[model samples]
Target chain A: MYCVHTTALSHRFSASQQVLKEIELAVPTGSIYGFLGPNGAGKTTTLRLLLGLIKKQQGEILLFDQPLHLHRLQLLRQTGSMIEVPSLYGHLTAKENLLIWQKLYQCPKPHIAEALQIVGLADTGNKRVRQFSLGMKQRLSIATAILHQPALLILDEPTNGLDPYGIIEMRDLLKTLNTQHGITIVISSHLLAEIEKLVTHTGIISAGRIVFQGTLNELVSRQQSESQMILQTANNTEAAQIVKTFVSDVVINAQHISMPLLSKEKIAALHRALVQHKIDVYEMNAIKKELETIFMELINQTKHD
Target chain B: MTNSFTNCLSAEWIKKRRSFSSWLVVVGACFIPLILTIMFLVYPKQILDLHHSGQFWRILQLRSWETMSIILLPMGIVLAVSLITQIEFKNNMWKQLHTAPVPFSSIYFSKLVLILLMLAQLFVLFNIATYVSVWIPALLNRDVPFPLYAINGTDVLKENGAYFIASLPLISLQFAISLQFKNFLVPIGAGLVLVVGGIIAHSWKYVYMLPPAYTALHFGEASGSTKHTDHNLTLWALGYFVVFVIIGYLLYVNRKEKG
Candidate 1:
């Protein structure tokens, strides 16, 4: 079953400027779905629409098989959301803040200690929130969201101001929350590298539209442009010509001539021909794929579309 | 609804207790009455005949409570307004309340009650100050005759109690205004201006609704006369309150969440 589903969701800021146009989104149950987009690409807007924070100009949203607008309050009880900066009273302590949230939610079990512990703020309960660091504030926010152990957690840029250690800790906490507690997470962020490691599935958005939505493996496999390869040889021009027969797109600008291979067998045949031609091959290797590159490619494709 | 209301009340109280503004309000509440008492003693107002104990008590009733309301009462209102509304505006606290499994009425009303409680605190402190200024000097064998007047066993309680009750409509109106503008200075400044304006407007008989200043103009009148004006008091205040509250709630319900 889909945890959150949005269809033809359209919203406009004023009568003239359109924010989101015919945006469709779906998140399957028990999947850590990463909503990736650059700044102002409508990631947060989409999340807000799904959660019913703002009224949609057009379309329908369903969460847990119920219409979001009709069942917002009921649906909110089963979902936890941390959007933008965590809003907390600076005067109150961490425990006090959590207690306020507990009262608001009226959760049967307060989970004050456990939630604090999850965020590693258990020892700092008595200290006022004003004294806490930015990373600590983000963690406390996470704790507030999951205090009731909701089935789905929606976090928008949860690791914004964290140092390396803080980022690692947040990553580990999210992993534990997903793996141990079996809570589905829908996180939206611009950090491709961070999302690449944590999310099981991703939806890349640009200009208020979903450019790509699939698993990371599928993302890497769908690159029909070329498998960027670097062949090191003494007779670079000769090897480039030989590779051109096996690979359709070949470029020989320098010593390292790059080509797109149709298959491994074709590359092997090219290698045999190179050896027979006495073209001393120094190195041949495929470039390692990175999500950043994939993201740029997808965004470029969307811009063209 | 009841549970959520209580929870929201407790949450607001907790926030208010820890707030610097709350402390400032309590300090201001205490300071305003104390300063007025000192000014009266040093300047020596012949506004009322202090020779008679009854007249002396009336002076305290008329002067201290009235003076405090001019600036201090409105200051208290501004404090309550700022403390309640600024939290949501400055941070994303509204989001927490927005998504919570509670009705909007609970969140809105709790803050309203807290503002009322703050006003109540100010009035209580004013009464205590009246007792000290009037009764304490009389006990110390000062020339003043019965500094604190006891009118048939109940003195300030009977007189000021009516005015306090009349001020409830003002409390609701000020709270509505405070919620409308999250800024502390705006409500505080506006309230101070209104109090001053109300005093100036009192000479004109048509100026009916401005309770704090008008109540000051006719401080110690017969029950029948006070009762006649009570209609003016209740109608105008309630009218302002209903309009303010309805407008405030509509604005609240229609407001969109900010990041």
Candidate 2:
């Protein structure tokens, strides 16, 4: 079951400025869907729309198979979200802060302790939130959202402002939340490198549109399909003449031949042919770092088009 | 009440604890009474004639509400209501709240309910403090004679009820403004301006139309200093209260950018 589904969702802030074009999002159940986009890429706006925090100008949003606008309260009851900063009361202690949401959601008293323990703030009693570090505040925010034990969690830039240690802690907590608790998580960030490790599904947004959305493996495979390998030879000019017949789109460089990424069998056959033609193979290096390149390429394509 | 509303109220009360407005209510209600108690304690002879004239409670009501109705009550509501409503804005929790399972109406009305409850709380405390202020002096001084008259419950209830009703329009106005603006001072500044306008125009013929002037007008009539040109001014206050509340709720719920 899809935890969240949006179809043809679009929004505009003003007459001249359209924030989101026609966009669709499908976040599968029990998966951590990473919504990736640079700053002002409408990631927050889309999350806000999904949470029903922003009035939909033009769109259809569904949470847990229920229409968002028609069943917002019901959907929201099963969803937890943290947008921008955690928005905690500075004067209230972590436990006290939890009590506020505890009353709102009508959760049992023990759930407060359970949530505080989950966030690793179990011992922060009588200590106001103002004194807590940024990472601690974010965790408390997650606890507040999960106090009701919602099925879906939507967090916008959950790791936006954290140190390396804090980022790792947040990632681990989210992983546990998704794995052990069976919660569907949609976490958005500008850096793919930040959430790439944690998200089971990825949705790359650019210019208020979904440029890429699929499983992480699919993204990797997409990158692989577009990847190429470089072959360095003792006599590259002669290898190019021999290589042009086997591999399509082979471009000869100063001392190497760049060709489409071939299968292992194809590469082995090509290597045997190069050897038979008396071209000494000096080195063969498959191009790495293709994922980031594809991400940039997708975003830049939208920018130019 | 539904569990959702009850939960909202409970949550609001928890958030209100230890907040500055909590202190404001206690101190705002007790400040004049405490000073009055000290004055009566220090100068027992100050009220010797009023006690003999059997106007002690009446004078106490007048004295208690004179500053209160003219400035303190209106301004306190302005500040206290804004403080309560601004909790979400100051903490940047509106987005967090808007995403919760409970309806937006629950959140909006719960905060309004809290503001009203606090105002009622202030009224009750101020009345109790007023009685305590007088009793302390009567007990401390033998000459004051306990005023020879039982406390006139009707007159006391009448005054408190009128002031409380008169305060409704102003309180709702403040709530509506506070929800729109994130800054604490805008509602307060507008409240201060309107209150000053009301006090200056307390004697004007059309003061009945001005909700901020209702408190002052009630004071003027209750003290017999001026006849209420319109007895339905309290009704007018109630009318304005309903209108402002409806407007505030609509503005809050209909916002394209809620959080």
Q: Considering every candidate listed, which one attains the maximal lDDT?
A: 2
lDDT of 1 by residue, B174-212 (tens): 666666665567866776677678767766666665654
**Interface Cα RMSD for candidate 1?**
2.0
Give per-residue CA lDDT, model 2, range A68-152, as digits (tens): 8898778887988899888899889999998888887777889999999998999988999989999999999999989999999
Supply DockQ values for each candidate.
0.52, 0.82
Native interface contacts retained, candidate 2: 0.88
Q: Model 1, A210-280: lDDT tens per residue? A: 88887867776765344578899998988888887786677887669887645678778888999999999
**Which DockQ-derived CAPRI band holds candidate 2?**
high
Worst 10 residues of 2 chain A by lDDT: A283-292
| Model 2 vs. true fold: TM | 0.96
Give the runs in model 1 whose Cα sits over 4 Å from its true position.
Answer: A108-110, A223-226, A232-258, A261-273, A276-279, B36-52, B55-59, B132-161, B181-193, B209-231
The DockQ leader among the candidates is 2
Candidate 1 clashes: the total is: 3
Question: RMSDs, each prediction?
Answer: 3.8, 1.8
Q: How does candidate 1 fare on TM-score?
A: 0.86
Residue A303's lDDT in candidate 1: 72
Q: lDDT, candidate 2, residue B147? A: 53
